[model samples]
Target: MPGNDVRFLLVDDIRENLVALEALLRRDGLEIHTAQSAAQALELMLVNDYALAFLDVHMPETDGYELAELMRGAERTRRLPIIFVTAADMDETRRFRGYEAGAVDFIFKPIDPVILKSKSEVFFQLGCQARDLARQRDEMRAMALHRDQAMARLKAHADNSPLATVELDCDLNLRVWSQGAERIFGHKTRDMLGRPVAGTRWLSEETIHLLRGWIADDEGQDSAPRYTTEAIAFHAGGHEIACELYASSLCEPEGQHRSLTLQVLDISERRQAEAMRSLLIGELNHRIKNTLANVQAIARQTLRQSTGLEDFDRSFSGRLQALSRAHSILSDATWSSAPLDDLIADQIKAGTLDGDRLRQSGPKVQISPENMLRLALTLHELGTNAQKYGALSRSGGEVHLSWRCEGEGLVLQWQERGGPHVTPPVRTGFGHTLIGASAGGQDGSVDVDWQPEGVIWTIRLTQGVTPVSGDAPVQKALTSVTVTEESLVGRRILMIEDEPLVALDLTFELEDVGAEVVAVARTLRDALREAADQMVDLALLDGNLGGEKVDAVAEILSRRGIPFCFVSGYGPEHLPAGFRTVPIVQKPVDPARLLSVLHQISVTPVAETL
Candidate 1:
């Protein structure tokens, strides 16, 4: 009700007196109803709610005191404030009777308007306060009803959700458990409710303790805290499963009485996917590293005794293209072998030998993967050599490339003519080694007859397993460069590589440049122990070791103040924050680039005595 609804009743046997009383007690927030007699006043009291009643003491049949008594008898108006105004000579006895008849106060015949109105105002204000209190109580009840309905809906939704929901009290004991929680943990709510989480074997001892600490402590945070982690959980039959937990505290908006809500999800499939992903990653890393090692070998061989970069670029690209073609064919064959014609066609395009100057006749034969790559590179090298000085150097020159099956084997020959005179190279280059390796298996041999008019090169292969080969032409020692001047001379290096071939290639490369490899580590464990125990000036590391990150090993090396570089197919983004400053080398490494990096970290001593 509005504040102006505070009503008052005025009564007297005289009409003018009733009007006078109404006017005297009038206020902006009060509605006054006047009556000239006790009967009309009683009727008004029954019809309307009133804050106070003003009545005259002297009346005909029933006086103001009697009406007040009547109001007091009825329960509805019993507490209403009543004030008596009278002209009769007043004494303490009459006042006592008025007070006993439920009169709150008395006014004399010549009423002091100030005292009447002030005293009347106090009762009006109390009635207003009482009304406001009752209204507030009703509104509070309504709001509480709505809040309960919303909570019921939320509880129903949470119970139906896939995530396991568990509620814990401030004492770290389970209070409420949902059906979803039972589904995940394999226990019914009846057995677990009101129980301490620490008592269950669902979580390990350490995890249980961790949870207790998290529940009781949020680092003194004033708001509800949240935490997420992956850990082990047990099934109803005692089988352990991987699960992720989302933990949080719930309470009022002001952050009181925090209760823990734990949501669990089964991560067994995700964990399995992660494991498979790791295995694939390791296998991919192995393939890439091995391929890179092969590339590295090819680079060394192609650049062997080269005079300049330009002189070697064409040779190296041609060799790499041949290797790519061989790989494409082998990949098509599922790494089994490559048809001999496919390789020849690849070289014909790569060597620019597709015109009349090139002629060929061959029966298709399947060469094993090892022999296929070597054969491709060997043919490429021969073509490049011929282009520079042999038959292809002259306008009238012609070349014949042919192969045929012989007694349980194959014979391939390249005959050149009508060009500059032919002569054998003084020292064996990459070409010689590649040809030798292509023919290295099972009585296979490569022969070059250098004649004045041309060169006749023949390669024979026996049918059997083509053995895996290693390295290009062995690097020649540089007598012109001394130990004191060599960049890596006397430097003890630690190598961490997961692939065997890549590791060996890197080690051989380092040894060729005068660096002493102190130890080789293939796993994080081995890397750490090696880093701690070995004495080395520098280290080489792979980004991943045995399917784990190398950052921990890198951290150890960093704390020891030993410099290192990462060499892996995994990129620089995979490097941890603390190790981002370190150098990185991707797979299929460029030999010159590797050399430059090695040189930057190698040990160089100046001649002090000289």
Candidate 2:
């Protein structure tokens, strides 16, 4: 829009002549103005530029020659092209007069239309070229300004960046060192510049040798060939730092290597942080496994101890809740050892002890996590018995619980008073076994005295307070299913179990009985693969494989005419409808019955065997 529009001038005494000229030169961008006299033309010329002007030579007042001379006299209009037009015959005097008046050319009328148009187009093209040159000049200035700003920004980034940049020449001499390099290496740029790279010791011996090998070999690479790798280097202050380096040649046009750039980034902090995180994660995993093993033990013992689901819900739930409380305290300390006071305080603070009726006094004794869990559970049981039957049941009752670490071991005494007469239980129970474990390791001992006035319990377990190495005792519940090794002889089993503990037990028991296990699948996909890909005989499938039902696996086995049964803790209805006759052994299954079922399915008549 700005570059369009060229102004034009036409000076003629006759209106017809002006109209004819305007029509010939008229175009979308040309703005042709007509003047009837030289005085009016002068007025138009004073206001605007004209790329080309057509002036009539003969006039009564101030002729074309005079007007052209006047335009040449003005500063702004001097470059304006004047073309003189005449109906008169060519004469030397007239041409001489026009040339003397600064006219560019003279045209004799009637005009040759082609020459007239061609002559005008030349001046128009010149005007466009002049405008383009001016625009180009302005653009070059803007580019220079931007280049300066960019250079300043690059300088600032290099100064503030954390990564080090070093330039080394072909002779292995440090040619340049950036401000970032100075900051990271704890050395000034002046101290590093022009120094020998090999002597710097920043590059390890192995890394230096690797770099040298790369440099010595000519791989005939393209422009900007480079190598990047991570290695360990020493800081200026004598500490190991992990650095990532990028090396490239600063070559000449002939393709000979001249120098290299080592863009070093320090990653020591990041790697250290990652290592610490990994250690913490591994510790957390170990603790979680321990907790899970404890839970498994509690579940089995609770089930064995209870009469029915209602009794289990009433009794076992409370016991597990007690264990959960102990876990919470340990978890708060990141499963590390907690003080003895906090261990015992957790039960009483959780409403086991009436705030006004319990008295506690013990020197601060630090207990390991393994002993802490057992001790917490024991205190919980004692408090439960006290509230239900002993001292805490009565308003006038009280409990004085204390512990002191002596030369023999840490001795804990629990004494209760002012309650109904106490009677000894007929036989030992799970609660006694759990409390007994608190005194020492799994082999710890507990002593209980039932007096008419109240009850007294003494525990001895301090020497073996370190962390437990093996699993809980009740985890051995799976061993109750007994089978002779010869019972399952020559049986081929495919085990599909997701639970690791259950899988371990099944593998161990089945292998002990001389079964040749063909495959063990942990996922439904794996089960399907085993069914389709492997030779499976008498498959054992869990009801759930990682949260998904093993419907597809079951269908595959059934369709293949394979004798497969399910071993799960679920009801028979949980299985697919097609295999109604397939025996489903509920979990905690007797190994003898499982073996018997496999024996029955694998049996063949004498005629069929032949």
Candidate 3:
């Protein structure tokens, strides 16, 4: 079927003439509309966009000449092609009238079919061509509009991007500078555009040569689309920044270079982060090796002191736990220091004797993690002896523990009373050797008074003491203690660990030791909230919570006087500066070590926060 716009109009007074004219013009892809009068043809012309109009010269009311003149007067059909037909005799005057009335061509009645068809075909082909031309114009206009919109979007993306977008002419003169370029190099678009790139401090002479080489080399091959490289760029302030550059050249079809585009990305922060990661890895490696060596030392020492497998297991396990306890305290203080009182309480168990049988008196003191572990093991041996043969073995027995600062040194005393008669051991065991070694530290002294009533052990440690000035002795007298894991039993503990597996393992470990895990937190906000809870008795903290330091939480815990220890794979350097003295437990935790820390730092029921 023909398109509605491809219609042709035929008007005549006689039906035969109109039919003959329509049959001559009709063909595929063409529609013919017939009208018996000029009024009917005018109506059809107003409704349809006709390609051509054939008018009858001899009409009833309006002749072809008159109709053609009228058609030219109207805007819609003003440019429409018209052909006139008639049976009137030929004359110059009539022909002049027909030509003056806007007829493009004329045909007489009884016209030859060949002449009629040939003349109408010319108008038909012209109409088709004109229609195609109009459609092509519309399509080209739409395409132009789309191209403009796409360019606008591309420009917006380039201007807003963080990567520096730069365009330079073949002469290395800047042609374009985006907003990101201004931010990265600290030069405005106006200042950079049309300026020689070599004039800027951002790019070196060698870099300019390389950029030029890219354009020169691009003419040879099309394999490598983009050239990537790293370079040192200078900021406007004269400082150096690391940058990664991605460059590509734009050229004509004949390989003539038009311009070059360079995308610059600042990688200064990324480089710093990578360096820090390497440092941390090295430090971690060193710490791991040191820890393994220490563990080997403990195992060897325990083996030498053992009488059998059972003895080795008991001694080795106890020592490791004591070490772990010291670490836990240090971790709490971010591996800085441990308290003297906590270290003392960790070794002695209340259930080993009557609740009132033990007494403690000491001013608050802080010691290094190394010293804390040393003192803990020494006290553990002493407590073991008391439980086996001294005051702790009998219900009516009594023990008194006390410490005081003396001339840049510390004096710790252990006295037992109301037990079986006392006597010196036939052989010096590992326990006695450990206790004696405690005094050998810092050129200190040891004195054991084997009195008939019980025994008295005193040691003077000359090093690793930070005394609290004007702090009167804290005299703690605890009673009604339970028998099992009494130091940690019923204690409300707050735990902060980012790792889910570690937190779950630790929760079970604490619970197994009779400590109540009041709450567990994996983030800074949660840790702070739990730390502020008054019901919290103690805390175990992971030094780093997903790259953030737990300084604020530690501060809250310290201010509240709630005892806490740290668990970390990192050393003191990674710890919170303010809480460096807190105990630290290394990663790949030995449960015994954690248990030891809990026991060592436990406080009595009557103990107050401050």
Candidate 4:
């Protein structure tokens, strides 16, 4: 009824009758394409999309009945609505033939306009509704296909994810289960589908009761919502596994209930890790307390047994402090790993080197915490020997320590020079037996070369050292800074820093050296703005800022032919990709060191800038 305007095709041999029918339907906006003969009417049918056709039965050639039969034979127009306008005198046999030719209705001649208008309107509304319904059906089919594809993608991700997933209906029947569920629960989906969840035997009684209670409370509610619970479940192999279950209710349109979806995940490993972490904390506390008590006992007994205060201080206090330093080194490494250089530094500070007498030179290397403790004791004994008769005893004498990576291992050399003349002792001391025996026990070898110049000791170790990779290339420090006569006075440098303190410190340091700090940007937004507007000669960038990386700034500066350097606390191994070619200075940088790096960049040729 909403779109009731019908388009009609009127065919007749007389033009006067077509005009009379058109006048009657003029108020309904009927579009009438009229034809003088049936042959012309058939031609009009070929080109137009008409809802209804009115024909005159008593034509000379190709009468209305014949034309209707022809129209019925055409595949394109076979279903078109046709009504005959004829004289009442037509016989019953001719009427039967008209019906057989696909005439929907017949009108007597002198053609009543009122009957014609009403019949045409009905067919037009029906045609419009049928077309609308067809379009709606096509749209619904496309939407269903798109929704199916989305559901398929979601199912694929759920199956592939590490977290286990399972779906169950309101009656607790298993519906959908993912491969991850099989791995976590050790149950195959084929054996579990359509089975009651409580009968699975893997679900604990407590978890089953919780699920039942939640469902019972939400009963009779059309808007079935989501809920979550965590509990322990048993695996197929009879192991108790902690799992977190995410459950949600599925419903059809019009608020009708369908089923429930459950996602199960095994959290057993995480739970066990938490429990073990608690035990480790308690154990660490007990060990530290016991170690302190042992040290106290040793100190009191050694002091009481000594003849004088000097002997008590040398034997009891110093040795306990040396042991304490070893413990500190182990603690700093989180009891997982330690740097050999750090262990050596800590031990030397406790005994002979006293900070000023220590001279360490080596590439960075990591050692296990267990080996670090053993090496700390060995080094403490060596330092004691040095303090008594070696280089550490004299003011000018010092220990020259160096280590390097060998084939699949590490070799550390500790040589003493400029102290007492060296010679092999006739009798091995307690320290000599411990160092030599411990090194050999760990599948390592120690060599003591008593040269006339000094005591040269080399230890080769096979374990607890990590070889440097390509990402962390070796960088040797310059022995001293080389300065030029040319001053960097009045040269402008752009400072891109995130921290206010570091930026302020750099600004002061740069101004002190006769260089102007043109602009300081604390974020990428501000830096880009300054770069676009200001004439920046050089840029000093921090690698990480608030949610933005410094690579973009570097790229912008590079394109503009402005030189820049990266100042970061991260090691060379952690630097951003493509930043290897860019110059970098590690932080906690000395003012003089920063100045030297900036000066080098300023003097570098333009072609060499990265």
Candidate 3 residues lying further than 4 Å off, grouped into runs, are 4-7, 35-48, 57-76, 86-122, 145-164, 178-191, 222-225, 234-240, 301-312, 325-610
TM-score for each candidate, following the candidate numbering? 0.40, 0.49, 0.57, 0.55
lDDT of 3: 0.79
Q: What is the C-alpha lDDT profile of model 2 across 1-610, one tens digit per residue?
A: 5344677788889999888888888777677889989999989988876788889999878989889899889898888889999999968998898988888898889988889889988887876776667679889889988998998897788788887878876677888788988888787887778888778877788987767765666355666568889999887898888888888866756778767777888888889889989998998899779878877887788788778987665556566656666665666666676666666655654555564677666555656677777777788778877888899898899787776666535777888989888889787667677677654555456888998898999887746333223422111001112223236677778888988888888788688788988878998888889988777567888888988988888888777767767887665566776666677765655455566666666663322211
Candidate 4 lDDT by residue in tens digits, 215-323: 6666546566788888888888998888888877777565645566777777888889999999999988987786677567657766665678877756554555556
Overall lDDT per candidate, in order of appearance: 0.76, 0.75, 0.79, 0.74
Residue pairs with backbone overlap in model 2 = 439-461
TM-score of 3: 0.57
Q: Count the backbone clashes (under 3 Å) in each candidate.
A: 0, 1, 20, 0
**Judged by lDDT relative to the true structure, which candidate is superior, 2 or 3?**
3
Please give the lDDT score at residue 427 for candidate 2. 74
Residue 359, candidate 1: Cα error in Å is 59
Error of 3 at 95 (Å): 7.0
Best by lDDT: 3
Error of 2 at 537 (Å): 53
What does candidate 3's lDDT look like per residue over 443-541, in tens digits? 888889999898998888787789877778898865633433345778899889999999999898788768899888999888888888657878888
For lDDT, candidate 1 versus 3, the one ahead is 3
Let me know the TM-score candidate 4 reaches against the reference structure. Answer: 0.55
